[model samples]
Structure formats: structure tokens, C-alpha cells
Target: MLKFKTMLILLVTMSIYSGNAVASPTSQVVKDRSYYEERGDIVWEVPTQKKTIAFTFDDGPDRKQTPKILEVLDQYQAKATFFVVGERVERFPEIVKLVLSKGHEVGNHSFYHPSFQNISKEKAVNEIGKTQQAILKATGHTAVLFRPPGGSYDQNIINVSKQNNLQLILWSWHQDTKDWRAPGVQRIANKVLKNVRNGDIILMHDYVYNSSQTSEALKIILPELKKQGYSFVTVSQLLSQKDNPNTHIKVTQ
Candidate 1:
């Protein structure tokens, strides 16, 4: 009993510290947004009364890592969105198929994973449009969501995305696990376990640099969040939601 109580106290303290590692989410909708804001073409979070989150992964369809992540999601019966790079999708189209076959989602994350902020309008168009074709060819999945590489965007990137009929998708403020950094498995797990809220879009990655920490962390994150009564959904599913009691309009940075 003493040991159990001590562990519980430790977890509580960890949660408090880990939860604030990122800035608190703001109810101030559309503060720093631009053309995308005017057209309502971007999203970070959509609050619904249902205890649900949109688990989004960027730069994926990696042969080994993606499959491992998929296995964990399958174990939990959780659905998520993979914002895949066009070149990677071309290289491992089967992985993309596996993602869709498992009832998950695929979105565009650019062909070369270039920063849209630094590229020209035409370059951005090539990246976004080519990726749309790549994802469609891979699994016949039309990627309506496009997340810019590194989550950095400018007016031209936004306009190009609009032309391609893609909605910009970024993650919720507090839910960045940064597992790609090979942070310890427990650290990656804690970042997510502590900060998740209803309608949050949690960011993770499958193609980390020499790291399997994401899949390992998912083993911890999925079951814990599931036990907390949170249901996971694709980004599109979260956006299509009807007004619920927990409706939150989060302003993206």
C-alpha cells in the first residue's frame, strides 16, 4: 500500500510538470492567422463533447516504422491520420495502402518536405499537387488535408494549398510529443499522456531519425488514453463533427 501510494504521488507530480511543457491552449481563435484564417482553411483543434482526439503523424509511410505504429493503433482500435511525404509515399506505396486498409487516413506533407515559407508559389504548388497525385496513386486516397513540412507556412503556401483543395492541418499546442528526437520512451509518453484534451490534434512522427521511440511511446499512450475514455479519430473525422458540449475553437500559432 505504501509503495502504491508513493507511485501515485509521483505520477501526479509528473503530470503537473509535463502538462505545462508547452504553452497553454488559447481560446483566442484566429489571432495570428492570415488568408487561411479568412477562408477557414486551417485547423489545429476542434472541440467536441465526445472524448476524442485526432492523432496526426507527419512525414510517414516509412517501411518499418509506419508498420510498427500501425500495429499499435490496431491493437487499440484507434484511427489516426498520416500526413505522408510524396517521395516516401512513392517509395513505400504499400505502407500507404496498409494505412488506408486499416481504416486510417493519409494527408499530404509535401514531396520533398520543403519549408513552404522558403519556397516560391510554383515550388509550393509542385510539392502539394505532386503529393496529392502520389497519395491518390498509392491507395486511391484523396488527401484533403495538407500539413506543411515543419508546420511552417506563408501566404503563398496557403494559397497553393487552397488551389489544390487541401485543408491545412497542424497539431494542438500542448500535445507535441517530439518523439522524433529520440527522447526517452517515458518522456515521449508523458508529453502526450498529460496534455491531451478533447478534440486535440496530437502530433507524432513515424519517420524519426534512428528512433523507434514513437511506436514504443504509442504502446503507452494509446492504452492509457483509451482507459481515460478518449476515442481516437482521423483529422477529417474530427473536423466533420457536430456541435458538442466540449466545443473548443483553438487558435493556431
Candidate 2:
């Protein structure tokens, strides 16, 4: 009788240990999901093996430069996203229309292009709200993406974005072309091509001081990347690719 009781106790202990070991993977998965939800408001890039990327241009609808950029994209049959300022969109409504007419996506870049880091919540809302209205007024298309001017944001910006149902879009740090600096055409191309990878979101500007170089850089970048088996897509399209289990959807904080 004593021996049987001891054996029964040992078996119960082993069963408990085995159960815990089996549950460990599930517990770890829950932890990972929690961590992802905590920071899901901002997306710098997506995770995928397919050679796809997004080229996002900011401060756009420039009368001279935007048209040139559009022409190059059309030549390559590449699609991009333009984060246009509200006031700029108002001034160049026709350009905004042209951007949409060409099948490129438009996102709000704020009304006056102020950094959201130091702005009050009301001001941040105004900047974003005004841009959404302006874009709709100009192009009759509602923008669902918002890129804070200068890529600056805080909890307030994130909260406001959620309230407005806009996803906070950011670019991969490694893929910034810095074409706004008029880094020579070769340098701009190199900056993007050297470190680019699958699922990278690249940052460029349409209303830069030396805008012509951006167009020139695109002329080099679009074809070369295409040759390397990369497909240029808008931000929305990149996020919507199917069967990517590793993709994390951006959720409201």
C-alpha cells in the first residue's frame, strides 16, 4: 500500500511538469501578441520574404517637381504614396488630382507641416483634420494614412490618429533617400539601394529645395530595383499582401 501511494504521487508530479512544458509555447505566443499590441500604432516596415517595398513622398503637389516625379513613376509603371500638406493641396488642387488620377495614393502630411512632438492635442488634431478635409476637398478621396511632419510623434499624436481612424505611417530608417538634401542623384540612389530589403518603406520628398534631383534619382532607382525583382507598391498594397503570417497589423494604442 505504501509503495503504491508513492508511485501515484510521483506520476502526478511528472504529469504537472509535462503539462507546464506543453503550455510554454502558448504562453510565449500570448506574450508576443501583447508586446505587438503595445506598439502597433506605428509601423516602420513589414515582415515578408517577397521583394516588395513602398516609396512614400512627403510635402508634395509641387507644381514643377511633382509633375516630373509623376512622369518618371508612370514610365516605370510603379506606384507610390504621396503625403501631401493640406495647404499645399489647396494651392495645387490640380496636382493633387493628377496624383490620384495616376493611381498613386495620397496621405495627410498635416496642414501647416508642424512637428507633432511638441504640439498640443488640439493642435495636432487640427493639423491632421484640416489635411484630411483638404485632401477630400481637392481630390474627393479620403486619406487613411498620416505621416507626421518630420516623422515626429508622441502618444498624443498616436491617440489622435486612432480617434481619426488613420494609421500612423513611418518609413524604414535604412531606406530614407534624403533626396531633400539634393544629395546628388547617384548618392540618393545608393542610399536607397545599398541597405534596402524586402518590405522596406522608403522616404523621399516631392517638394524639396532641389526637386529635380529626386526625379533623376527615381529614374535610376525605379528600373534598377525592378531589375533586381523588387515591386514598388503603395503603402496600403504592401500591407495587404496575403498569406504573410508574420505581418503585424497596426492597432490603436
Candidate 3:
């Protein structure tokens, strides 16, 4: 009888202790971010709502890869945001049309994608303004969002973009496939599948870099994300879900 009682006491103790350990981390995070004001180099998501995610492609509107990426998105009926380089838009105007016609969105990625930190303010405006012109010319729509090349930006970069009436955009999280180096398709797919969550802004390239692997990974990831009950949306749409007060970041102009 004493042996059974001892075993029961140990099991009860273990369960209570384990629950506390598991619950403490979440409590700590809630405590930390409660007073934190989201600012630069920040990426976040709301926790208290339905599952949704945004997929954004940067440095794109490429001749080869953009079209293929579009085809896949069409297959899944997924909408996305394409941050097109101005020079690339000039080179592939039809790709821009395809992106717009399909009800996807286009944003500014600078005309030449130069390092915004080093360029003079005048040059910076030119880089972003030229792209805005190209996008408007191609799709008859002006981009409202701008993502600095390599995500390198500062107060000056943001100011220049806003002068052109473009909002500065950066991501909350990444799968970090490094697909530029031609990572394997399955490996890339697995990485995204394992990490993707609601309100995530997944970064991928729609240009000609590592086209095959990116396409293959898309084939795998789309179905998997769907299986997890996530609806794919553009970045703008993701930002529009503002009623879920648990959002990790909010931009107030």
C-alpha cells in the first residue's frame, strides 16, 4: 500500500511540475512584450486568432521565374505581393501585367536595387521613383509599398520612400532557404513547412535565380500550408486583419 501511494505521489508531482515548466515560458514572453514598443528590425504576428499567412516575393517580375511562379500561384488560387525592381519591370512589362491581371499586388523594390544606406537622398528618390513610374506604366497602378534592397534601410530610406508616397515594408520572419545557392527543393520545402505560421511574411525570389528549386518548393509548400488550414494572402491583406488585437506589430502613420 505504501509503495502504491509513493508512486501516486511521484506521478502527481511530475505532472504538476511539468505543467508549470511548460507554462512559464509563455508567461515570460507575455510579460516581456507587454511593455515593448515595436520598432526597427522588428517582425511579429498576432496570436489570438485564425490562421493566415502572407507570401511576398522580392527582386522580381523576372522573365522566366516570375511566369512560372504565377502559374503555380494560379494553380493554388493563392494571392501574393511581388516587390519588383524598377529595372526589371522595364525589362519585363508583360510579367507585370500578368501579376496585376491575376489580382496580385506589386510593390517597389527600387529601380536598381542599390544599397540605400550609401546612396544620396536624390539618388535614393530616383531609384524608388523610377520603379514607381515603371510599375504605373506597366499596370497602370502605383505601388504603395517599398522594400529596400537586401532589406537595408534607415530613417533616410524610409523618408525617401514616403516622399514618393510609398510605405516602407520589411518582413516579420523568414524560412531562410538561401535558395540563391541552389538549395535542394525538398530541403527548402521542409524548412518552410516546419516553420510557417499565421501572419508570417515568407520571403522568396521570383526572379531567375534558382528557378527550378523555387518552383519545386512552391509545389510542395502550397499544399502543405493549405493542409494546415492556412489561407494565403498578400501582405496588404494580412495587414488588414487588424481586429485581432494580439498583432505583434502595427504601423501608425
Candidate 4:
């Protein structure tokens, strides 16, 4: 009994040290996009026949990068979604308002950009509530869409979002441009131009650490995608048309 107890303690120590003890990604269930979307708990991408894609920019209301990205979008007559950080929205209200005024949609990204899975339920609620208040105060538009920081979420995050009436949104698995990594202009452009499909929610960031390459990548992506017969739409617009009876949904791998 003593030897068995000693081995169990050693194993527990090893597990903790290896970081295997941390309960993360909270939801244990691994399912497809349709499962979450149908339940309305989370939405990664919507099915559609309009050939419309939702381009969502996170961590924004950036003073410099945002306006440049806006210019690129305007050049193509594309409509996209900007998921604005709460504090940034507060500091750059005009930028948030400009995003709305420019025929784009703004969604709530948490105030401090903390991963919801890492925080407690109370703090998670505060993060969503405060950000919602900030966006509404600044843009005079309530955000109906909420994308968790770093795409991190748990049941608590989902519950709080439903209580607040915000749709929890995520990007298509294939359409993440990873612009925040500053993965080079060509690579970012290539990710979208190559993998893009109807109903994809493309992820790009308007506010990245230090300088942003996203605005530059957009110059390459937007025109080529437009030529490929793709039109960008806000996430809400994509969701609205997803259930249209006349629309034919495509098979996704």
C-alpha cells in the first residue's frame, strides 16, 4: 500500500509538471461546425450559395493599420467584419464609428483580450459585458456578434454570450490568414486565395503586435479573390443568408 501510494504521488507530480493537469479548451466534445451552429452555441462558418465569404478582423480599431485596411476594402467594394477590442474601441471611438460608417460590421472582442477559458465565470461575464458596453457607447451600435479572444471559449463563455444575446463567432479552420503572426505578405495572401470557399469566415487581424502586415496582404488577396468571383460580406449577412431555402450549400472537407 505504501509503495502504491508513493507511485501515484509521483505520477501526479509528473502530470502537473508536464502541464497535463490543466483543464483547457474547456469543452471536451470534438464535433463539426454543423453541430455548434445548429445549437447556436458557436458558429465557425455558415453554409451558403451566394458565393459570399465573411472576412473578420480581430484586435482592432487600430489607429494606423485599420484605416489602411479600410482603404484596401473600399478599393474592392468589399464588406467585412471588424472584431474590436473594448479598450481600443474606447480609445479610438472614431475608428470604431468609422468602421461602422464604412459599411462594415463591428463585433466584440474582450476588453483585455484574455482567453475566456483561462478566466473564471465572473470575470468572463465582466469581460463580455464591459466590452459590449464600450462598443455600444462608442459606435452607438450594439454588437450582436462576439468572438472570444484567441478563439478561446468554454461553456461559461457560451452561456454568458447567449444570456447577452451575442452570437459566438469563429473563423473557418482553413481560412485563418494568421496575419497576426506577420507570416509575410505573400503567405497571408496565399492562405486565402488558395483555401477560400463559399461560406468561409476568413480570419485576419487589423491590430497585430507591433506593425501589421495584414493591410499589405489585403492588397494582394482582395483583388485576386474578387477576380475569382468572391464577394465579401459581414458575418451577420452571412448568417442571415445561411438558412435561405433557395440557397444550395456546398460539401466541405
Best by lDDT: 4
lDDT of 3: 0.70
Worst 10 residues of 4 by lDDT: 15-24
Off by over 4 Å in 1: 1-31, 34-39, 242-253
Residue 192 lDDT (model 2):
85
Kindly report which residue stretches of model 4 are placed more than 4 angstroms away from their true locations once superposed: 1-34, 243-253
User: Model 1: which ten-residue window has the lowest total lDDT?
Assistant: 21-30
Each prediction's TM-score against the native? 0.83, 0.81, 0.78, 0.85
Rank the models by TM-score, top first: 4, 1, 2, 3
Clashes of each: 0, 0, 1, 0
- Residue pairs of candidate 2 with colliding backbone atoms: none
Tens digits of per-residue lDDT for model 3 on 117-199?
34676787789888999999988998988877665544566567768877666554444455555668888788678877667
Instruction: Report the Cα lDDT for candidate 4.
Output: 0.81
Best by TM-score: 4
Point out the higher-scoring one by TM-score: 1 or 2. Answer: 1
- Shift in Å, residue 224, candidate 1: 0.9
lDDT of 1 by residue, 191-233 (tens): 8888877888898998998889999999999999999999999
Candidate 2 lDDT by residue in tens digits, 1-253:
9998896555333321121111111121213222422466766777767799999999988999999999999999899999999999999999999999999999989999875535787898899999999999998899999888766655677788888899988777677777777869999999888877888888899998755899999998999999999998999998776235555534211
RMSD of 2: 14.1
Candidate 4 clashing pairs?
A: none
Model 3: worst 10 consecutive residues (lDDT sum): 17-26
